[model samples]
Target: MRIAYRVETVRAAEQELIARLPDGALMQRAAAGLAAATAGMLGRVYGARVVVLAGSGDNGGDALYAGARLARRGAGVSAVLLAPDRAHPDGLAAFLRAGGRVADDPYDVLAAADLVLDGITGIGGHGGLRPDAVPVARAARGSNALVVAVDLPSGIEADSGEVLGEALHADATVTFGAYKPGLLVDPAHAYTGAVRLVDIGLEPHLPSVPDCEALQHADVAQLLPVPTGESDKYRRGVVGIVAGSARYPGAAVLAVAGALHGGAGAVRYVGPAADDVIARFPETLVSAGPPAKAGRVQAWVVGPGLGDAPGVEEVLAADVPVLVDADGLRGLDPAVVRDRAAPTLLTPHAGEAAALLGVSRAEVESARLRSVRELADRYGATVLLKGSTTLVADPGGRAPVRVNPTGTSWLATAGSGDVLSGLAGSLLAAGLTARDAGSVAAYLHGLSARHAANGAPLTASSVASSLTNAWRDVYA
Candidate 1:
């Protein structure tokens, strides 16, 4: 699992490490890492033109010292001190001694630079860039040089992942100590192209738990249930799906398609689309009326294409874990969900999430991390906020929010969410917690989309079909 800590936690860890180390030791370590990473990116550092955007903080000192190292290796490095007066005296002297020059015109140096280091602002910066620095940052962006941010890009809320205003977009970000929440979540994540973590000996002092986490293939493999010789259909667990209406039968078929490949031994589908679902997937145990009468199921998935049909209440009333999606999320009451004894998973896209929170879709998109966390706490249910970067946040905010890293935009097709809804519900039936189920489902679903698409546009059915390969990929 890849974990991300908040800025304050990282700061605390850095302080602890710095206290025990020699004076300037911590900063030197950071500078060395930065220089090495920058060198690797440049490939041939000798005679390469490198421009460092230095500010009035330690972040700037790291860049300056890194520039000094590059200069020593025969790179033509120059510093554009955004705050010349407040720049690190020691770092400045080192750069000067190493044959680095301070640029007379920032634009002139930025224009010809092969690489640009954005050290104007660090993780602590808020409310965007200073007025004086905006033009220079914009120029850096407009330049042909590869932009690499120091620690984090300027103007993003490290904890919340919110972009306050105009921010510098980096081709890559070299974050030290640990990963910040902003580096993983979107809005800020979009600004960061590729992120590289440089260890500065801070993890030993940091907390065991992180603010955010993303499951890798190995982690998901451990959570996935495997059957034994004694396992039967019932023993392996059955997932009940309450989806599709007369208006939309494909939703039910796609949902069942995903469930069959979701590692659940059996799938019991209860909806008006029974005939349509049976026609496609005969293995599905189809039923009518409420989900409670759909025989015994370990978990229930309700909502996709429900279209004002009545099943959300029936499924929620069941003692088993329930996952609500699509139409099931329409005008959902918090009190009802909060009062349920069993774990409830609510899967909502940005628009639906906005409606549930009484906020605009734009607000939800802009601050996805905060919105997902708030929704989970408000409904007292686990929330799977579906987007480019899928996030699964459990109720009460105790656990780290799991971010799904695998995905392609091709998964944005119409019935894709329906497939995801069933996949997650099946995992729930297989005995995974709401958080685990959601995150694992998302990971597989995204990998399936990638496999199915393969650079071409894929349909929901194709994604469902690719699940077998995706599951195998995890094991491999």
Candidate 2:
């Protein structure tokens, strides 16, 4: 698993580590890692052109010191001082001693640079770039050089993952000490290309719990349901699905398809599309009327094309874990969900999430981390904010938010979310907590989509059918 800490936690840890080390030792550690990363990107440090976009603080110092190291290796290193008087004094002296020259014109050197170290702003800088630095930041991005951001991509809210106003775009980001939340979550995550973490001996000082966590294959393998000798159709767990309408029966088909592969012992589907579902998947237990009349089930999945459905309230009243999605998510009573004895998982895309929050879609998209957490807190349920980056946030903000790393843009096809809703709901039936069910389902859902597509267009059915491959890939 990959864990990310908040800015405050990381800063506290850095300060503690710095106090224990000799004077200037901490900065030297960062500079050495930064220099090594730069060299690796450049391949041949000798006869290469390197430019440092230096600002006014320790972040700028890291760049200047790195530039000095490059200069010693015979790279023609130049510094573009956004704050000439405010640049790191010791770092500047060291750069000059190593034959690094301050650039007469920022644009001139950036145009010919082989690599640009973006140290204009650090984790502390937020609300975008200063007015004076915007043009140079743009020029560096427009250049052919590989832009490597120090710590963060600058102008991103390190804690909230919001990219306000203007921020520099990097080809890669070399972060030190610990991973910050901004590097892992979008929309700031989009600005940070590939991220490389440099250890500066701050791990021992940091807390165990992180702000957010991204699960890997091995982590997910442990969570997958494996049937034991005592396990049967009922013992493995049964998932009840209340989905589809007379108008849209395809949703029922797709949802059942996903649930069938979701490690559930049996799927009891109760809706208007029973005939359609039974026709597609004959093994499904079909029924009419409310969810309570569908026999016993460990969990319920409500609303995926359930237009003006009447079964949502009935499912909510049950003492089993419930997953609400699509049309079922509309007009949800926060008090009802909050007071429930069983866990509830809410899956909503940007538009659906916005409607629930009573905000605009753009607002939710811009601040995804905040939006997911807010939705989770408001309803007192687990929220899976589905988009380019799928985030599952637990209620009350006690545990770290889980980010799905396997998401593919190809999973944007219609009805894909319905498939995800069923898969997650089935996991809920299989005894996974709301948080675990949502995150694990998202991980597999994304991986399955990638397997089905393989760089081509894929339908929601293809994603559902590829679950076996995804499972094998995980177990392998």
Candidate 3:
């Protein structure tokens, strides 16, 4: 697992190493790694034009020191000092001694450079680029040079992955110590093109668990439950779905359609659209009463196209793990969710999440990590914020946030979310914890959507059908 420590933690670790080792040793290691990375990019360091966008912190120090290494190798290295007065004295001295030049004009340097190293900000920065640094950032973006961020791209919140202000888009980001959360998540992630972790021997000092984690194929496959020879239908786990209404039969069918592919032993669907659900999926056990009366289910998925229906209250009253999505999230009773005996999961897109918080959709989108955590804390449940980067946060605060990386814009089709609700609910029924269930289902759902689309338009049914292949791919 790739663990990402908080900035403070990383700072502490750096200090500890510095205290033990010789002074400036760690920075030199970081600088050397960066020089090697940049050299590889230029093919040959000699005669290569390299520009380092230097800031006031150790990030700039790293860039300058790396520039010195390149200069020693006969490269034409220039530093665009964002804060020349506050720059690291040792780094500046080393660069000057190695025959590096300081660029008076950032645009001129960017125009002629083969590669640009963004050292303007590291994990310490909170907001976007400072006003003085903005022009250089823009110039790098528009230039022909291949931009590489030294630690993290400036103007991005390293912890939350939110782009605070104007950010430089990097062709590749060479991060030190460990993978920061921002590089793996969205908004900021979009600017961080390709991320490479330059191990500076800091992992042992970091936490065992990360602030958030993105699943790999093996991790997802391991988390997926498999049936035993003696397992019966009920033993495998039963998923109870309460969805649809007279006005939205398709919602019920789509939800059940996803549930059918779940490794669950059986699916018991209860709601007003029982007849329609049965018509589409004859394999489902359809019932006409409340979810509690539907009898023995490991998990319950409520509210797809529930349409202000009367039965939602009944389903919400169930003791089993419940997943609320779509219309079910509309004017949801926080008390009902908070008081539930079993774990509850809420899957809401930005619009629905905005409604829950009484905030604008743009606000929710801007700070998605904070929004998901806030929602999970407020409702005392798990929240899966569905969007460009789906984030799953647990209320208990025991685990790191799970960011869904295998998502595609094609998954934006109608009824796609209903399928996710069912898939996650089934995972809950199969005995995974709320956090695991939500994250696992998201991974599978995203993979299924990609498989179904395959660069073409797809419907809800196709996504459901693609689950088998998705599952096989995970196992394979």
Go through the candidates in order and give each one's C-alpha lDDT.
0.93, 0.94, 0.88
- Per-residue lDDT tens digits for candidate 3, residues 235-256, read 7889999899898889999899
Query: Which whole-number lDDT from 0 to 100 does residue 390 have in model 3?
Result: 94
- Of 2 and 3, which scores higher on lDDT? 2
The residue-by-residue lDDT of candidate 2 on 57-136, one tens digit each, is 99999999999999999999999999999999999999999999999999999999999999999889989999999999
Candidates sorted on TM-score, descending: 1, 2, 3
Count the clashes in each prediction: 0, 0, 0
**Tens-digit lDDT track of model 1 for 80-183:** 99999999899899999999999999999999999999999888999899999999999999999999999999877888888889899999999998999999
**TM-score of each candidate structure, all chains considered together:** 0.99, 0.98, 0.95
Residues forming the 10-long window of minimal summed lDDT in candidate 2: 154-163
Ordering by lDDT? 2, 1, 3
**Clash pairs detected, candidate 3:** none
